[model samples]
Target chain A: MPRSAHRRPAAGRLRGARGLAGWLFVLPALAFYAVFVLRPIALTLQYSLYDWDGIGPSTWVGAANYGKVFTDPDLFDSLVNAFKLIVFFSAIPVVLGLAIAATIRRIAASRLALVARTVLFLPQVIPLVAAGIAWSWLLASTGVINQLLSLVGLGGVTRAWLGDFATALPAVGMIGAWVLLGLCTLLLLAGMSKIDPALYEAARLDGAGPWREFVSITVPSLRQEIAVCVTVTVIAALASFDIIYIATQGGPGNTTMVPGLQIFYLAFSEREVGTASALAVVLMVLVIACALPIQWFAKDGNK
Target chain B: MARRVRPGRSGAALVIAMGTLAAACAAPGSNSPQPQATGTSAVSKAPACGSAPITMNGYFETGFPLPKALTTEFTKQHPNVTWNVREDQFAVITQNAPRVLADNPPDLMRLPQVSELVKDNLLKNLDGYATAFGWDKWPASQLEQLRLGPGGRPRGEGSLYALGLNMSMTGVFYNKKLAAQIGMTTPPATLAELDEVLAKAKNAGITPIVQFNGGATGGLAFPLQSLMAAYGPTGPINDWIFQKPGATIDTPSNQQAVQHLEKWIKAGYFQKDVNAVDYATMMSRFIDGQGLIMFNGDWESGNLDKQMPGNVGFTLMPPAQQGGKRAAMSAPLAFGIAANAKNADCAAFFLNWVATDKRAREIGVEIGGSRPMGPADAYMPEVAADKVTASTLEAGADIAKDNGAMDFIANATGAIYAKSWTPNLQKLVAGKQTAQGLLTAVQADYARQLEGN
Candidate 1:
């Protein structure tokens, strides 16, 4: 007992030294995070309470900017548009990704599968801005899309997809879907690889069809992956800026005005730093509100 | 359990660090000096470049080749002076100006909208440099747009805060071949004549006007503003743009102008897919003879001349009536020195040299395709009569002679262009907005922004 008690003190000392070394190793990253992320967040919170133009003296107008975020129709409408984007940015990608992943799983050993995987994932590799520009050209009134439509005798319905009031937002959302589909598919495919073949074989022995096996085993196994995809894509939809900025720029009569672009216009274009900061805070809260539920639901599903 | 404990500990640490940072740094703009009106006499005389080498830092708009050519020439002329220049898109410059002026304070920067920067005390008062270099002796209209009254109100009537690199004017550029096809020899001198030309061009199956209305550029505003000038006096328009008290763009005359523009839109004078066309596309379509005319500025003259030499013609927007005075959106390519610029003297010297030097004036004409701002009788660069640039320059002179120059309405506020005018114009193109609604909405937005400021 005396030897054991003596050893415990040495072990405690050793643990203390290791902890200090570990902290030292991570100190640089911690400092960077504090400066870049934490500091900016704190500053944004502080700035949200003021009426400042980013330059000039600021006035303390506590919560007025936040009030504007909710009360202003333009601002509120932007939030709604962001929510609408989730269907394309999150839901469509996830469903389509699952289907693609399931199909690829059957032909996983073939060379064509490799090519399919690479082709499907190409959108994920392109920069968002380049993707935006390319998509904008393809969607223009006289662009390749219209050319193809005309060839197929669909020319009468052809219009400027990005410049139309009814189609601008959906067109932008479709671009989002295209960019995220690749990422979601690759994630789901990776999840599908880990599923036990035995489970599928057992389903087959039970007279289950391909659809039933997919629904019963593959989906249950991918709960966490789907949740991850939902969380990431939902965040992308809510915080989307680059593609919208390069493509529509919240134009065609503000039909595609998302909160991300709205905040940029407020702070940078309008010089309304206070309102921009307030909108940013609200967006962050909304993202957290969205992501936390998915995470909790995923954890519950796991149990 | 250990991992959970670590995250909690880290969260507390982050809070502590953030609190420390919040305390360490003062609120942004808290320490900034309250903007006070500086007297004209408070400016200091610009010193000559001495033997010591000076490397002036400049922030310029990207894609404009004139600034680069000018800087290179300046360096060659004065071996002791060199340039370290950075370039960005104009929109990016508008966003970055405040920070750049506050932190880095470039010696020279392309000032797109100077009123806000001036009100923030980020721009240097150039009255003394103007006096020293006799810029005051130049045409009053030349420096009018660059001046701002106290607190940046009534922009054309106070201390000079910036100088023009060159004077740029916007007008109608027509495809000569297309115009001939429509049997138009001389440029239209009246609105009725212009309509006749447009209808003739349309009947001949040529696009009348190729004005872009896509994305963020809103090239439609160019024609809209020109129409505004055609139907009314420019005083109220300029007043509204300069944020003059009681000024409104929703005046009766301007409404008439908008109605005229709507008539053109309804008459199919523009391309069917005009809303989808961007500035580049519009320019390309115009160059390819897809359109008979394009509402653009002299900035395209140099390029257009090179692309379709002797195939394009420039003219002012015709007046509402025969022989009536005409106006154009004529403004300077304004550049200013930062309030805290280290090489203010050298920057001022370079600006002066750009205007007065013979080689500089020639470069300004050949490359910039804009009139160099100097004394009314200053040496003017001669160009071939057939070049599109010459016609544009001649139009600029006519604008100056009539004292009919006005600022682009897009420069009224930093956000007005993108947030208000652009969307409203897009809505107009989409048939979702009316002319009256467009003006009212824009005025309301302008008033709200002014109130916020």
Candidate 2:
């Protein structure tokens, strides 16, 4: 009885030592996360409660900066624009990714399929800033798109796609779609490869056509991947800065302004650090509010 | 299960520890005035740099070769002095200036907007250096824009905080070949005559004026400000820009200027894709002979001399009526010393050399493509009469005679250019906004920014 009791304490000590070792192993990563991520978030929250020009005196103006974020037309309009971008950045890419993944599955053994995947994924390899610049050139009034339209006897419709008010937002959205489509397609393709072939065979035996098999077997099986794509792309659309900054800089009368760019201008250009921090905090909440639902839906689907 | 719970407890402890560290690092209110550094009086009165080797740190605007060229020449002439320079785009400099000036303050920095910095006590007051170096003897208008009154309100009236490397003036640059093709033998002398030339160029199927309205740089503001100078006296405009009490940009004369710019837009004189063209693309298109005229500053004089040679001509934007007093957007390429600079004497000496030295003045003309700001009798560099630089220099004299120099509207506030003017001008080009709406929107934004300040 004494031996067993002594052994119990020894085992407990062993377990405690193991725990300490595990924590030691994670210390570096934890330190980085604390310094880079958590600290900035906490600082942002603190800054949101004050009025600062980043260098001069700061005044406590609790909630006034947040009030401006909701009441200011420019700030509010940027949020609306980001939400609208989700249609192009998230919806179109996801839908197209499903279609492309299905088609690639049919030709999985062919060499053409390899080339197709590579070509479609090419945009993902290019830097977003470079892609934006190349796209701007292609969309300019005297660019290849207009030249092609002229050649097709549709010259009357040629205008600067990125410089027109009605078209600028859609144009920027299309660029986002172009950049994100490749990522989505590859992710969904990977998920499709993991789906049980028996499920597809069963659907086929039920007299289901290619479309029915895809609807009944493929999509249901790839819910997790679709959820991931929506979450990532929605975040990308919301946090977008580099592409829009390079292409339009929130111009053509602020048609393409997003919260990310607006926050940048408020902080750096306007020197309104408190308002910028407030907007940043709001953006973080928005991202979380959007991501949580998708994550829950994906997790709930597993049950 | 016990192990997992232990990690969770440790994670919570780690977060608490991090929160405390961040709270400790959070800065307290920084409004308390710093102690004034002494020994500046002695340095300001020094006639020449000491023989000891000195490294002057500088921050300059990228894409402008003049600053770099001048620095290199200064180092060569004064063998004891060297430089460590950093360059960034003008927009980036504007965004980074406050932080850069406060921490890691460069000995000399390109200051695009000075009032806010002076208000924050980030810039060294140059009044003592001005008196010591006899800068007060120079043309009053030359140093006018560099001075700021109390509280940094009403610029042009108080202690000087910066000095110009050279005087820069904005005017209309025309393609001589395109002008002749449009039946123009000389530069236009009146607003009506300019309109006739623009109409003629349009009828001849040439882009009349290729102004950039794209992205962030909004080149449209150039012609818009020029038009403002043409339609009205420059005093009220300066008053508005200098932030005089009760000053407003919504004045009737300025409204007339906006209307005139709108008329030009409606005439399709600009390229259909003007709003899509960036600054670099506009310069390239103009250099390729795609446009008859472009509104630009004298800083491009040397560049045009190399690329298009004698095929280009420059003239001040003509007045509203024949023989009316002309005005132009004229300001210095201003540089200032940081409040915490370690080498104030060396920097002041360099500024004086850039103005008074004969070789330095030549570099200012031949390299900077702008007139050096010095005494009224300072040495003038010789350029061939037919060179574009010569015409720009002559226009400088005309602007001086008219006492019609004005600062760029973009410099009115640090954020006004990016937040208000660029967007409004882009809307104007897109046909989504009216002239009056543009003015009103900009004025409202200006008021809001000032209130925040």
Candidate 3:
């Protein structure tokens, strides 16, 4: 009993030391969040209740700005387009990533797999605006895309791709998919690597085909990466601004006016800080609604 | 190089601290008293920089070649003035004015459109100082045209705030060959004639017009103003801005003007998706000869001529009806000495020299003119080469005095005007919205904004 009591103080001291180190390591990140993230958000919330013009003293307008923004049909247009992109644009990356990851892990051609990953990730490194500029030229009225389509006897499809309302959002989303391809591939490939290969080997030994083994092993193992990819892509999709701005600036008659673009024009162009801040707040609430449930409960769902 | 000091305005420009009493300085009186505003002969020697160069900050307009060329000439004349120019695509000047005024606003700057500054009390009155400098000789019409104060009243009603660099006149740029190809003897001079041309152009597999209406609805207002001049009466445009007696946007003339724009859109005279083309793309397509005609201003001539590989020509914007009096929108544009400027003397001297001296004429001709105000003498000599631009400027001078030229922010086009008329104008042209439907909505929005303001 005396020896047990003597050991207790040492254990308490060890726990205290670990806790101190953990905080010390995270201190820089915590400081960054306070300065860049928390502070701006707090300031934005305050501004949302005013009729400020990005200058001069703000006048309290109660909830007037919020009411106008919510009732505006233009804001509704942007929100609907954002969801459409998540289903159409964001899903492409997940499917493509899975296929590429499977091929890389199964092919046994290490050099080819390494080269493919490197090339795919190159688009990720291109500055978003520069990348959008490149796409704009490609999809221009007389650019390479039309030329290729013409060769296939699809000349009827030719038009200003980004200028057309029906095709603008889809075309922009496709570019997003192309840009994120590398990041998705790398994440899924990482998950594939972590799955014990012996499970695959055992399945093969029992005369299970490739499809059966992949479903039992790879799919179950990749649930985490899929969640990560969806969450990240959805966030990126919702926050899409630079590409859209540089390309169209939300035109073809407001068809491309995503919420982010709306927020930018409201804050910077029209100088409607109250409305823009409210939009930002609205966006945060939407993102949390979309991402929280899946992350909170589904992290351990796959078994 | 050596620093040069302007004799006349240096004292006024001294950057006294906000705490210092302004009582010692007398407020300058009305500048519209008698002689040339700024002239080379007006340059005097005496005041020099106290210690460091006088610093000037401004929201600079003009892009690429023009800006580069002008800055070179301006810098060569004044070595003591260290200027920092910031470029903005839109009304960045208006947005930045309060910050600049509250926390060390630039000693000198350009505001794209003025009323916002004047309304906010951010500008300085250049009355007595400007008058002493011979700027007072400017005609009564010229002072009123500058709208130095609110309600579109005379500069005499309040303090002089800003001056424009040059005025812009929106005109149509057409392919000389295309007009000839359509077998039209000459370009249309009236709205009905222009319509016939559009119909004929469409029949010939050519787009009738190319516009940046999609890029910014500012262009949309150009045609509307032209219509008021040609189809109905200019009284509504001039007097309605100040809530003056006589006319309003709700008047019959304005409704007719709106109907005319709707007709053009519904008829597909311009491109179908008008909103898709930004200013650059819109002008470039016209310059490329994709469309037979386009509507813009004189400043665009320099821009379009370069983009056009072959040939380009200009004419006054056609009137809305046949045989309508060809009225043109006119306003004042000139340079002014800043009230709080450290080198007020230098700024005044530079502006004065640019206004009247022979050297001013030389510089002004090479560039578009510094004085876009509507007067025969106000034009830069280069306009003499283009008969169309020359005549338009002449016409602009005739009506430049109408209702004191410049309009206010709340009156010209407010948020309601934008929401109701501008966007729907495109849909109307696309044949989606009926003319009456669009105009009714626009009138409602305009009234709402007027009430709110």
Best DockQ among the predictions, by candidate number: 2
Candidate 2 CAPRI level: medium
Question: Where is the poorest 10-residue window by lDDT in model 1 chain A?
Answer: A1-10
Rank candidates, DockQ, best first.
2, 1, 3
- Ranking 2 against 3 by lDDT, winner: 2
Each prediction's RMSD to truth: 2.9, 2.9, 11.5
lDDT of 3 by residue, A1-303 (tens): 123433556865544454444454555676566556665776677677777655444567878877876787777678777777786456999898888888888864778988888888898899999988899778776779988999899998887677666777787888888888889999999888898989999999999997898788888878888888888888888878878877776655566778898887666545577888888888888888988875865566764
Worst 10 residues of 3 chain B by lDDT: B27-36
True contacts recovered per prediction: 0.56, 0.56, 0.11
Alpha-carbon deviation at B337 in model 3, angstroms: 7.4
lDDT of each: 0.89, 0.89, 0.62
Chain B TM-score for all candidates, comma-separated: 0.95, 0.95, 0.75
How much lDDT does candidate 1 score?
0.89
Q: Write the per-residue lDDT of candidate 1 for residues B8-66, one digit (tens) a residue.
A: 55676677686757663566687774554565564456556666988999999999999
In model 2, where do residues sit more than 4 Å from their true spots?
A1-13, B1-12, B19-21, B24-44
